[model samples]
Target: MDLLKSLLVSASGLKAQNGRMRIIAENVANANSTGRTPQDDPYRRKIATFRSHFDKELGAEKVELGKVARDESDFDTRYEPGHPAADANGYVKLPNVNTLIETVDMREAQRSYEANLNVIESTRTMLQRTIDILKS
Candidate 1:
């Protein structure tokens, strides 16, 4: 039962990390996306939050993906008078998405996912070993 619960917890973490990875990917994809028109806003970076809930059936605390919120931080302004999205003041609003930040987030999420996978794999191996010992 404990092993099962452990596996469930790890699975939840994997799911959460996967969600985070997806958000990071989206940010990276829209890093260069600027507003088409002067009146339109540029792409905003998306952030993922995780929630922990107790699963009665699994008897463990499982992680769940929380609301995907947008970063409300100020958009970067670039002086591009020739750009279509440039305002009358010759300032263009660039996307809030930072490629370096997104890249770092992606790497962190990947590591977390890999860690959760390792936990699941280890749990399975331990369970197998226990069964083998019982048989012997």
Candidate 2:
């Protein structure tokens, strides 16, 4: 593939990974958050999705960030009688966001982002070398 198309592919990947990281960070930040009222639901974990499509402009497959989906899993409950959001049974609804899972997802997104960055760097280097060869 041409250098420009390679750069475009890498750029798309970088954008997708960056979006995934943002979603993971938001989940981590709200892990301990509880609802304001017993009837109110706590923060739900968000999942990041990606879609691959053929780009006519680039004439290659490119990845993009898809819709942010909600985690339909049940929320965790903690016994906290004194808590304002506690129910009659002294159970407070906690976010389903698991810190460990979020950490792992963040790490994976970071690695993917780094890989795309490396590809862009390599492509740039090759483009520069080609220019130098032509000028010599």
Candidate 3:
């Protein structure tokens, strides 16, 4: 019974982590994206937040995505006089996204997702063993 509940909890974790990975991937995809106008801002990196809630049905504290918050850090500027988004001073505002950071976040999300998958797999194995024992 508790194992079934654990499966539910792990499923929630997998969902949350999958969402987090999606956000991270978006950030990475927009790393080189810039605005078309000089006065416009470039793409901003988004971070995924998680919160835990007690699920009455599963009787466990499950995690869920809270918000996709924007990164407030300053955008990196590059000297690109020919670029359309270049300012009067020939400086272009690049997206406030770092590939290294996104890569790290993606790896973390992948690990968390894998961990949840392992939990689900183990629980299913236990359930199958129980059924076999009963049949024997």
Candidate 4:
């Protein structure tokens, strides 16, 4: 029963990490995305926050996505007067997404996801062994 509860908690973590990964992927995909018009703002970086909640059924704290927030930091300015999205002063606002930071976040999320998957695998193996022992 305890193992099952642990597995459930880990499953929640996996789900949360999966969501985080998706957001990271989206950020990477849109890193170079610019505004359609001069008045529009460029793409802002998205951040994922995780929170732990008590699960009565599992009797444990499980992780979940708290919020997907937009990074409010100012975008980088580039001198691209020829660009279509350039401002009147010949400056273009670049997206706030930093490829290096996103890549690191993605790697961390992938590792966390894999760790949760391993926990599920081990829990399932233990459960199967217990069932086998009881059958024998």
Runs in model 2 with CA error above 4 Å? Answer: none
Arranged by TM-score with the best first, the candidates are 2, 3, 1, 4
- How would you encode candidate 4's per-residue C-alpha lDDT over 65-102 as one tens digit per residue? 98899999999888989999999999888899999999
**Residue-wise lDDT of candidate 1 within 24-95, one digit each (tens)?**
998988888999989989999999999999888877789989999999999999999999999999999989
Clashing pairs in 4: none
lDDT of 3 by residue, 3-108 (tens): 9898999999999999999999899999999999999999999989999999887778999999789899999999999999999999999999999999998998
Off by over 4 Å in 4: none
Relative to the true structure, candidate 4 reaches a TM of 0.95
When sorted by lDDT, best at the front, the candidate numbers are 2, 3, 4, 1
- In candidate 2, the residue pairs with backbone N, CA or C atoms under 3 Å apart (3 or more residues apart, or in different chains) clash, namely none
Error of 4 at 57 (Å): 2.5
Model 3 alpha-carbon drift over 4 Å, by segment: none
In candidate 4 the C-alpha lDDT for residue 125 amounts to: 96
In terms of lDDT, the poorest run of 10 residues in model 2 is 32-41
Error of 4 at 63 (Å): 1.1
lDDT of 2 by residue, 1-136 (tens): 9999999999999999999999999999999999999999999999999999999988999999999999999999999999999999999999999999999999999999999999999999999999999999
